[model samples]
Target: MCPPNCLHAVCEKATRRGLLKSGFTLGIAAMAGAGSLAGGARPASAATDTGPLSFSKITDMSHTLYEGFPTFSGERWFEMERPVTWEKDRVNLNRWTLMEHTGTHIDAPLHFSEDGNSVDLIPVADLLCPLAIIDIRAKAAADADAYLTPDDIAAWEAQHGEIPEGACVAMNSGWAAHLKTEKYTGLDAEGKNHTPGFHHEAARFLIEERSVRGIAVDTLSLDRGLASGEFPVHYDWLGSGRWGVECIASMDEIAPSGAYVFVGAPKVAGGSGGPSRIVALH
Candidate 1:
């Protein structure tokens, strides 16, 4: 048993281990910016090193999972069944059925690359990093198929300083508010979708130039809803051995540049994608 005075530390240790079992790492929530928490939380060798930041509130950046939630074309929706209700079995056990890519989730490299790492194999450092929020909501509102260009990223960097190498760059398309409506998907008469996403140039710049950990978006897919032919964005990014986070929620609540994002997903051995709980601490 932990000593009374060691309760806090013990709890933190337990929490960290539990997260690892769940396919997450407390390092994602604890450490931010361009650093890595690969092996585990900071070692005892660096216990006293408080490089930057002190205290802050953690914000939930994921969506609520429920039956009939939105889904991409040809993907299964979410479902929940309480097979063992408390009244019947003196316990409450739930059985869930949903697509790996449903709701807010991380698209591991395997989603696009034939021999890439699966969700469980993605390094902890990649899921946890400083967030670069590019606000192009106004442009998206005017044009449903708006693309976040390199110029937009440059403008954001001009104000927030250069995006740190290995950070997670997220597109703030202001689409979360419309999730309850058909407009969130923005399907057109020809059955084509019109959603905002990063331009090919922007993705290339973030990957090749910035050396970012990955890209994220608050929409159905990382690529625009109306992307024609092959998913060039996915092919370009994930195919390059990186990952993607999609359907992120609550971008408006966090700061544009300083927050740290934590992505928690199930450790499905070879899952190409999976349901995730993403959050940010500012």
Candidate 2:
């Protein structure tokens, strides 16, 4: 069963209590592990005002990195000493290497789009969008080789509602939970990853039928980890001017099925995909 504290389908691992000063950066709050909403938070009630005037802020879905966390291959690590210190009335800050996709992040067209938009090329407005999350955790748990099909999505719509056009259609397959354990990622005996992904039909349905802005997932890649040589899914999705969002976390808590989704990715000068922070507001 899902945990009660979970909002947006994410499970809260821990929580802290404190009064936050105004103008604290999210990075700072995240580093301090204070006052932020726990993971898997529910959306505000319909009667409640969710606008700026209403809630101060909900849970931040992004994950942080230091030690004792899931590192993407060799992309993330810490040095012997701290990188920043407010030492005796003076602060010394240092620069360290950060991979394009570390912690909680989104991928750009350049991630898979050969001749498509780079991290900097995508419009800021385009970063924020309406969302549609289709949960397939149960099916995925039953079969690691499971895939998202139009039929499955159609079944969801039979209950939830239709997938809107130009919206960010996110699939919360509950894969992030598997990040800590080998069983979560469902990696095979041969080191091959076995995870849930969208079928070509589902991708086509979103790209053509739903006219989606893009597709996002809580996994490493949008395509099924064990593709049998053919990558029609990638070729079709990116080739059709649509993009993909990967390595995302904390999507399950979102309710209303359709809400505005946003991304704050670094616009590296002449960069490729780079890293991004994703947000969702109903």
| TM-score, prediction 2 | 0.71
Task: Name the best candidate (by lDDT).
Answer: 1
lDDT agreement of model 2 with the native: 0.60
- TM-score for every candidate vs. truth? 0.82, 0.71
* Candidate 1 lDDT, 39-79, residue by residue in tens: 12221112123344332456788998778777645345888
Once fitted onto the true fold, the runs of candidate 1 whose alpha carbons sit more than 4 angstroms away are: 1-53, 74-76, 226-229
Location of the lowest summed lDDT over 10 successive residues in candidate 2: 31-40
| Residues 125-157 of candidate 2: C-alpha lDDT, one tens digit per residue | 455555778888898888887888898889878
TM-score of 1: 0.82
